[model samples]
Target: MENGVKKQDQLTPPPVPRVAVVLFVLKGKSVLLGRRRSSVGDSTFALPGGHLEFGESFEECAARELKEETGLDIGKREYLTVTNNVFVEAPKPSHYVTIFLRGVLVDPDQVPQNLEPEKCYGWDWYDWDDLPNPLFWPLEKMVRSGFSPFPTE
Candidate 1:
């Protein structure tokens, strides 16, 4: 105890690395994306996702986020590659260890709806060959790394 105070170990530890679980709901030759309107990655296209909750698995986080953000429920959560994203140029610098997830919609007719207008502008399907510009940094990284959610028939 220096200066009449306890050692640093007496204090609480820092938070863990931020983890974002994203779901890629694949359709025929296209995947779903939402136009973001939030502070971190505003005006860019992003997949449905959110921060991983404590004591939750990746698949549970993905399914929960999808339902909360887009009002679409998905099953058969398949683990995909993860990306380490650091956004240094944003108004608020941030980092995320993004866990990618793939799932087909349980109902083919169940399309995405904008459940959180405050965070998302809208949702749409984008073909991999023609993705929207200014993609979310993690997604851009994923594309640049030659990752695809589509399965070869």
Candidate 2:
């Protein structure tokens, strides 16, 4: 009881689930990924993505996040699959349904830059068979499920 009034913790509402949009920019046999440096999955390699904004479509979120995180524009987006990520070991102990999308770079010669230096350590291309160590949970789940972002030439 506080301020002469009774309090009940059970009355508190549960937190809402979150959604994230992840895009795999494919160019031939390589895919773009960044080394995460944030609290959620620090030191893990992850695709370019961000929290889904309210009232935004998956395609829109993918494009926005790609530009915001990599400074590269996407041409056409292909809907991939969604992964339900429950990060029990996360610093915030959060859950997310990550929508995956794949697309090619609009400009073949364009290079990815470290747009968000505080969150990521720039972007680099990695082959499917040889990815960096300690991948983010969602990406690891996708990989372990035999989900190939690049299935064709």
Best by lDDT: 2
Task: List, residue by residue over 59-134, the lDDT tens digit for candidate 1.
Answer: 9999999999888889799897888877778786677899998998889789788989999999999998999999
Q: Model 2 over residues 36-121: C-alpha lDDT tens digits?
A: 99888898999999999999999999999999998999999989888787877877778898899999999988999999999998
Question: Residue 134 CA error for candidate 2 (Å)?
Answer: 1.1
In model 2, where do residues sit more than 4 Å from their true spots? Answer: 1-13
What candidate 1 gets wrong by more than 4 Å, as runs, is 1-16
lDDT, model 1: 0.87
For all candidates, what are the clash counts?
0, 0
Best by TM-score: 2
Error of 2 at 7 (Å): 5.2
